[model samples]
Target chain A: MGDFLETDEKVLISLCKRGDLSAYDRLMQRYEKKVYALCFRMVGNQDDAADLAQEAFLKAFRALSSFNGQAQFSTWLYRIVTNTCLDEQRRQARRPQLLSLDKPLNTEDGQLLLTLPAEASDPLDTALSQETEAEIKTLLSMLPASQRIVLVLRDMEGYSYEEIAQILNINGGTVKSRLNRARARLRDLYLKKEELFRPTVHLNRKERRDRL
Target chain B: MSCEKFTKNMGAYLDCVLSGKELSEFQEHLSVCNTCRQEAEELQSMFSWLKQAGELTPPKDLRKSVLAELKKEQGRKGIRSFPGFSYAAPAAVVLIMLVVGNLSLLLPLHVSDAVPMRAAYQQESGTVTPPADAIIYTEDSPDNEQVSEKSELSSEVERNPSPRLLVLNLVLIPLFLFFSLRFQQNRKEAG
Candidate 1:
């Protein structure tokens, strides 16, 4: 955190309204991580998440004048992120492209970026963990966009029901109902993947035996 | 709470958003009912997994790229709001209005000619004169004097068609347009 990070958001917003680019940059730095995190979870793709997050910040800056300070700036930004992700999802559905080949495959020096190499020594453990993570992502992608957004806001992002409703521009009851349905749907999907859970069960049993 | 009600409220309960009394009842039910307990545990486990999976670091260059994009956008806005450029639209409108107004003044004043004055004069002469009471404007009447004054003013207008009002309208139209555009820009910025 910098000096601007310690400054109040209202002060920063005021400065941004005055066309202070530094203030806007500081605002971006403060919320960029959380915004990216939300976008990544919603889209389940890093490239799309990065694009969506960037678009969201740009939109926030453009529409900063319209921000009436009714909601927290973070909430407003989250709403933008959520809407951007949803729009991206809708666009992808219409076009149905498997990969964004137009995007660069590597850095300028031909160095691969975003490679998540496993630190674990056991290849089987690494493979199992990656598979389980992939399976969860698949299950999340299976949900309707609305339900998935509510689920991500509630369970993943730890937003309150009221905050999720405000962000989605829906009622609190609707958020709760959607969250419930999303949880139930996710549980059903997880149950269907019984094999994915078997390794964890075995690991737990083996650890228990070793402790005994 | 009944098992059915508990089932409906299970998600909210896991989130700990249930009302206090409802939460207590839910906990009591969970302690007693194996089915509800298992269901709650599964939901909790699923949520826990989602939380863990959702924690991802954004790319290192995202902030840099976003800032660069913001700078570009700001530059575009700066160009738009440049003092000279911002006033250019209104200035052009004023110039156009001035040229049009001057051209209109140079053109013949055909509006007076378009009126059927000969027919009006013939009708006034051919019509029967009204009775004294019906004729509201008597010779000694102030109304009669006012009618003569109005006719004299009309003749004066026919002799010299002044473009003062036309000039005023031309000036006002551009002024209105300029102010309206400025107002709209201000509103856009505020919004």
Candidate 2:
């Protein structure tokens, strides 16, 4: 048992494949915290994240025979955890989006401002720095799953673009574009929640013209 | 560059993927464009906050729960992988090898090393080896008669290899099919 702690990940995986339960436990211990944290960010909760992490681990164990070592083990495990959360998200009814990132938002200043949901009464009432992680997490949950995942991976988890591409099974260009879009959306969400909910009304091009 | 076009390149500019002339074009646009510059800075600050934010601490029991779940799965996997097909397939192989091994023991069949194959038998399965260090095949033990019979059979095969080989094949084919079918059934149940 102590020897397993000293073993590398590859040897531990091989031992796991050969039905060494202790080896798998060692591997689980190495990754459980990371997986749980990822799941929490994806699912936006603690209990559900724990359950999702466990489910992902079980699924990975069952599919162990198919896990060729082409990608790193952590990468493969992250893929499973991300997929598990996405699948769970699909099972539940999603909240309707108040603002669509796809819309071409034109402000009075002629700039396309991708602002947060107007439903927030006065989010910026408090100082931006006073904004809590809990608020950001909530705001993140409101973003589309596709965009949310990219933002979480690139911004919060700090995975490189290439690593995210491999984990998401997308190409590098797709990763960049998705990450850009995700950051844009998250910025809008966070700003709307923490800084944009202020005294000024951002009139669209048509609204300004009408007023003029 | 047009702001419309710059919109597409905004990500690249922020990512620093733009270079040389392309980079100059983006910077020149941002230098003149208040909106785009302000947007970039806001996006930059927001993302920096995300990056710098401390990771949430995972629940303390997360490891324990995952391990508990895995242990339960391991038990079920053990059950499904053992008995029935898995056990039968190997047992059948050992049975055929036992015939060949026992035949070689006395008569020297085509694949020799019969002599009751205690060592090979031990390797094939623990079926023959009793739990604990109990004596096996002692002079008065009931296992002795079966051991003697295997040796007698081996001598017969040593005298006649061709006929014995044909008979072993006949016994092997049906046993193979039977074990394989049962193994599939076990797999289906497990699945």
Candidate 3:
């Protein structure tokens, strides 16, 4: 399976370099979702994720000549995505803005404008699980950008420490320390929100059993 | 292992990167230490929750939009790689600077009268006189016509410097410095 994927990637890359837009399109189709997922988790916002993911692909295409094939194409693509996200975060830091949490922030005449659905309305959103996810995202955002990137790449994306170090252009020791600090901070946050992380259904089941 | 030592190595231990003697020693500490055991359990649960959060599927339009953007970029690249296109921006900037510099030099000045007055004052006071090559065009000078031409050129440059050139120098110098520093920083970071 690995050999097949590597071969397919090599063929697509050759075609892409030759200005084959269709081949590039096929390559994007293959990895767009994964790239978007990584961006979404890193930035913690859907719109920014989409924008950053698109930028990463665009940058990858422009810099395709420099892709020396030292690493897997996906790894190189991910490094671009990570750098793009970090740059965006740095730009945003220079000009911070306050965001309102309330959805459907306004109404125009009789119609709703900018109506964003609350997590409660999401189909996949169980209350406890959604709360846990939201809390985790909040905690992740609290981390410094360097530590947050390493944590997301390591724990969430399951990239090896070496891969992450390579992606960030840092050494393994720095990666280890950053990941450890991020994990410790997150663990501390989770401890505070332990109630939200508890198994709600199991608790309900036990309560019902006791009542019966 | 001491509690402090265990705490320091807890992350590596949880990642299962510690091996053999250290791993065994950590396990023994966990077995005997209630506080460390609880800490380990909490760290394990937190990691589990993180994994469960999982990857999300991007919006359906993402692929189409990305391809569209890439096509637009490719079109731009096509235009940019055309012959002489790459040098256009730098060439334009240099051309502007040269034109502005020459224009500033050629502009008329109000300093023609002051030159002789300064020269006379310097000679009478036995102070540092103007450069011997700089012909001070006075009413009594032998080469009055030649001195007038040289004086006109020097006076224009010394007295009536173009505001546009001044503004360009002010802006471009700082911009050049800023970009130089930024490039150095980027190189440092890249390395």
Candidate 4:
């Protein structure tokens, strides 16, 4: 993958400027997953994430001519995604909140916490992992949109502090501080749910066998 | 580093953003201090779990929908299609209308037309008679005499065109008033 990506990005960008949809498609395919992931985690919902991602790509296409190649291609893309996601977040905030509307995430073990429907299974994780995933996502939603976005990019996306700052148009120090604060809050929330981190006890021989 | 300092710089240190010297110093301190080491481990675990959360894929239909919207936007780029069409269109129309409306004035009027108009104005005014010394320069005059005669004629026009200015003002003031009143009425109608 790295070898395929090693071709000069400027060449791809120029091709895109010349209306080469294939080159633009390649660029989109390359970053779509990461960008969507960033949007998904930041917005805390899948549908909104998809909308923001598409809008971000369209915005990037419109701005391709104005792109003076001053910044790296990925950096420019990240800025577009960040701005689009933030706009969506603002719009979502204006709309009425639909509390208790979404299905509870599924967990691994048969021991259920929040019940989920038979459908809507995601491929990325097992039931238990999905539960944990959904829990963290909910916790992240408690943060201000700015802090949530910075933390998502910095932590889950593994973006460097400078990259986060560039994407968010903030200084690196602000990125670092916000990440610290966000992570601290996350840790507090995680520690509050002690059962997730603490080892589970097996009650029966059958249960122990199932765990094994 | 004390626990306080390590905690304060934990975000920076983990991001590998501290100065090289400061990083080495922090590491040197970490080698001796157990509390900072433990804090670093906890921070590392926090970020590790976060990273492990992984990505969420967007819906398959989003690309199609957005591109469909973009295709609609292509037509809206009409405003930029012709580089100077917006500016040139109105100007060309106005210029053509002006040339067509006043083509007679732009082309020279014959002496017959001027003589009749002058005679009619004289009869109508009755206040001033044509000057006795009004010498219309003839083509038979010598070149130097023609030059002097033209200069004298120009000087006479220069001294006397104030009457033309006054005549223009007299004709235009009522026109101005009529248009001004019409403009105000149109504005009121619009409001």
Please tell me which predicted candidate would have the highest DockQ against the true structure. 1
Pairs that clash in candidate 1: A65-B191, A66-B191
lDDT by residue (B1-191, candidate 2, tens digit) is 36777777887777676899988988999999998898899888887777644455566776677667767766877766666746666576858786775566436434455434544445434455532222334356666555545544544544565675667767766777777777777665443
Task: Please rank every candidate by lDDT, starting with the best.
Answer: 3, 1, 2, 4
The digit string of per-residue lDDT tens for model 2 on A110-139 reads 434353442222354444332355556566
lDDT of 1 by residue, B1-191 (tens): 46888888988888777888998988889899999999888888887676556346677788788778777766766666666565666667777877677556544444444144433433543443322332355367675554444444444545554566465677668795766689558636633
Per-residue CA lDDT of model 3 for B57-112, tens digit only, reads 77778778867876776686676656654345545665676677655555433345
Over A18-57, each residue of candidate 4 has an lDDT whose tens digit, in order, gives: 7666677777877888888888887777777787888898
Scored by TM against the true chain B, the candidates give 0.48, 0.42, 0.46, 0.37
lDDT of 4 by residue, B1-191 (tens): 35676677877888777777878878887889887788678778767666556456667776667556656665544543466544454455545644554443423333434445455534543423343222333344564344445445444544444565455556555655555556455433322
DockQ of 4: 0.20
* Model 3 stretches astray by more than 4 angstroms: A97-128, A194-212, B87-191
Worst 10 residues of 2 chain A by lDDT: A113-122
DockQ of each: 0.29, 0.21, 0.26, 0.20
Comparison by lDDT, 1 against 4, better one: 1
TM-score of each: 0.62, 0.59, 0.65, 0.60
* Number of the predicted model whose lDDT against the real structure is largest: 3
Estimate, for each residue in A1-212, the C-alpha lDDT of model 1 and write its tens digit: 55554458889999988878788888888888889988877776678888898889888888888898888888888898999999988887799555432121343444222223332334544324665565566667768888889988888778898899999999988887888888899898777666433322123455768989
